[model samples]
Target chain A: MSFINYAAREINVKIVYYGPGLCGKTTNLQYIYERSNPQQKGRLISLATETDRTLFFDFLPLDLGTVRGFKTRFHLYTVPGQVFYDASRKLILKGVDGVVFVADSQEARMDANVESLRNLEDNLRENGFELKAIPYVLQFNKRDLPTAVSVDEMYRLLNYKGEPTYEAIAPQGMGVFETLKAVAKQVLYELRRK
Target chain B: MDAGLVMYEEEFDRITSILNRLRVESSANIVFLVDKNGQQIAGAGEIDRVDTTSLASLTAGNVAATDGLAKLIGEKEFSILFHEGKKDNIHISIVGQRLILVVIFDERSSLGLVRLRVRKAAAEIERVLTQMEAKAKEVGAMEAASPFAEITDEDIDALFSE
Candidate 1:
């Protein structure tokens, strides 16, 4: 849910990066954290296992300066993409304002992508939100991989809603900000429409 | 705006004062109010000593995880959570069913005292939240335009401008 603090002159919104295991959800957050100026970003907290896989969630709070007089802050979160972490993912989606489905573009992970999308829909419903009614986008990550499937096929399978889609190499920082921007823009537009 | 939490200056001050009073009455090191979604609404008592942003986010996440556990166990909700640390003990409770009330106390105060103060404060905070919700609806209906209505594409683009 979007939080508008009229007293503080701040607008806080949440955007969750979601996908199957190793779909570069955390990588997208890491790249953004590395690129953002210290004044624009807070510490990136990762609740991960000893092996570095996200056990709970990765949180990055970005201060996008201000629009009008309200300081717009986006709390970016990434769920534990592994299947058994579905409970953690559902918790993270409780009050999400926007979502970025970071689909691994490799042909081998096609099934994972589909299953994760279905999971996203179901979890969203559990939280009283419908995927189609929220500010959402698709990021076809790992485009740099030689085994990556074609963007057209990824879109054919994933972008059923025809929402904004970005081709990304998340670790290389390609399309990371673009994917974020697309969803953030949608969120702002929705806020104004309210 | 629908179902989202909007904090106006008036209600924020009222809530902050309650927190301030709770901090003093409970002899707590710090006290803060966070929305269930992890937004820091108001804080009191040595807030600078803690990272309020991370604290709020993590606290909300903890509450959320606990709620999940509650559902799995066939409970309606946990409602209250407490963590006993070596020095500073933390107490968290759901207020108004939408806000999280968190108090960090230490050897200076006992859990019973903190819980007592929190129980009283939660009632006041819930009343304020109810007023906040009603006030928000009143303003929303009268205005017919959001504060963001004046924001343009150019404004949004400028936010991303390096």
Candidate 2:
């Protein structure tokens, strides 16, 4: 849910990066945290396990410049992508304003991608939101790998809504900003419509 | 998820007053109200050293996780959560269905007293939020013409222009 605080002159939106395990969800956040100017961002908090896997979520607050006198703050979060963490994933999506599905673009992870997508839909439904109605984008990550699936094939399986999709090599920061901007724009546009 | 929150000046003032009163009466170091979705609505008391944005987010996450656990145990929901630290402690409770009231205190107060004051404060906060939601629905039509509605794609692109 977007919180428009007219009194504070701040508009806060929650955007969650979601996908299967090791699909570059955390990398997407880390790239943004590294590239954003210090003044434009807050501390990036990662709640992960000993093996460096995301245990709960990763949170980064980015202050995109003001729009119509209201400062735009997007609190970006990434859900733990492992299958057994469904409870944690549902908790993270409680009040999401937008979503970026970071699908692993490797042929071997196709089943994981499809399962995660179905999980996203079910979780969104449980939270009273329909996937089609929310501001959503797709990020086909791991594009630098030789084993990565073709963008066309990934789209055919995942881009059911034909939402804005991008190819990302998250570690190298490729398509990170593009994905962020696409989702942010859609969220802002949705806010205006309300 | 019901709708975006729109807080008018009067509603904000009333809610802040209640929070401030709760802080004083409960002897809490800080008190704040956040939506169930993790947005800091209003806060009171000593907050300079506190990172409220992150606190709000984590508190909401904690509540949601706890609620899930409650469901697994055959409960409708767990409406209150308390975490005790060595010197400081946090008490979180649900206000209505869409807001969370959090109180942070130290050795200055006992959990018993904080809980008492929070119970009273939560009632008032819930009333205020209920009215605010009603007012939002009433004025929501006019929001279509608000200044935010004037934002353009160029404005968004300009944000990343450095």
Candidate 3:
């Protein structure tokens, strides 16, 4: 839910980077934090386990230039990729402005990716926002990995029709901003349309 | 408004610098400032990975609910909520009357440092925000001078059409 401040003349939107465990969800954020101008980005917060597994979520706030005169700020988030943290994941999706599904390209994690996408939809449904209603994008990550599945294979398995998707090697920063911009554009387009 | 309460570009930049300095000095992963209702005001660090928006909203919701529950039991609003899960621990503290400052850290960052850094940042943030809010309210008051101040019924629908 956005808090409209007529004073700042800016609209703030919250976008979440969600995916299965070890799918480079965190790495994507690390890459963004590394490359983004310090002035435009915020601290990356990760709630991970004692062993360093993400337990709750991670956060970063970013400013995506401007639309009209409004400085658009997006609050990015990643839910813990571990399967059992479904409750926490649901909590994170409440009132989300958009979603970036980071699907692992590894053939082995196919089930996890599908399951995670399904869970994303289920959670959205529970919040009264369906997969179609929410502005969402896809990132096929870990392209540098040798055992990574082909783009065609991943697409066939993790099918989300009509939404913009990207092929990313998130660690090396490939397709990071492209993905962010696409979704941000969609969000602003939605805002402008309103 | 207090003249000393301004958070201009220079002041805002200084605060961002302070956030990074503290994060690096403290070795914390995520640190952020959110309004009383869970809207993020400013933040620093590997922020793209976490969900600060929901964190802000949920943290506010959690605090409010707990406070409500506490009131029913004849207690004041809870000031902080520290949750230690199996892997991560969350330190949620109210910053002045305006916002909540949240810091999430792993074993790499020491608890004592996070506590110390957050304590110092909270005071400055409170002062900065108090001033910003006042300025914002002033601007809002001025906007009422517009003819569109009397927005029509169809305008509301058109505004949310997207």
For this target, which candidate reaches the highest lDDT against the unseen true structure?
Answer: 1
Error of 3 at A82 (Å): 0.5
In angstroms, the error of model 2 at B148 is 2.2
Is candidate 1 or 2 superior in DockQ?
1
Evaluating just chain A, the predictions reach TM-scores of 0.99, 0.99, 0.95
Docking tier of model 2: it is medium
Better of 1 and 3 by TM-score: 1
lDDT for each residue of candidate 1 in A17-84, tens digit (9 for 90 to 100): 99999999999999999999999998899999999999999999999888888999999999999999
Cα TM-score per model = 0.98, 0.97, 0.61
True-structure lDDT of candidate 3:
0.72
lDDT of 3 by residue, A52-149 (tens): 77787777777665444456578777888989877777767766778899999888899999999999999888766778877889999888889899
lDDT digits (tens) for residues A1-194 of candidate 2:
88887778889999999999999999999999999999999888888999999999999989999998889999999999999999999989987999999999889999999999999999999988999999999999999889999888889999969799999999999999999999999999888777
Per-residue lDDT over B2-94 for candidate 2, one digit per residue giving the tens place of the 0 to 100 score: 877878779889999999999999999999999988888999999888888889888888888888899899998889999999999999999
The candidates' DockQ values read: 0.70, 0.69, 0.06
Measured over all alpha carbons after superposition, the RMSD of each candidate to the real structure, in angstroms, is 1.1, 1.3, 11.0
Note the residue pairs that clash in candidate 1.
Answer: A1-A95
- Highest-scoring model, TM-score: 1
Best by DockQ: 1
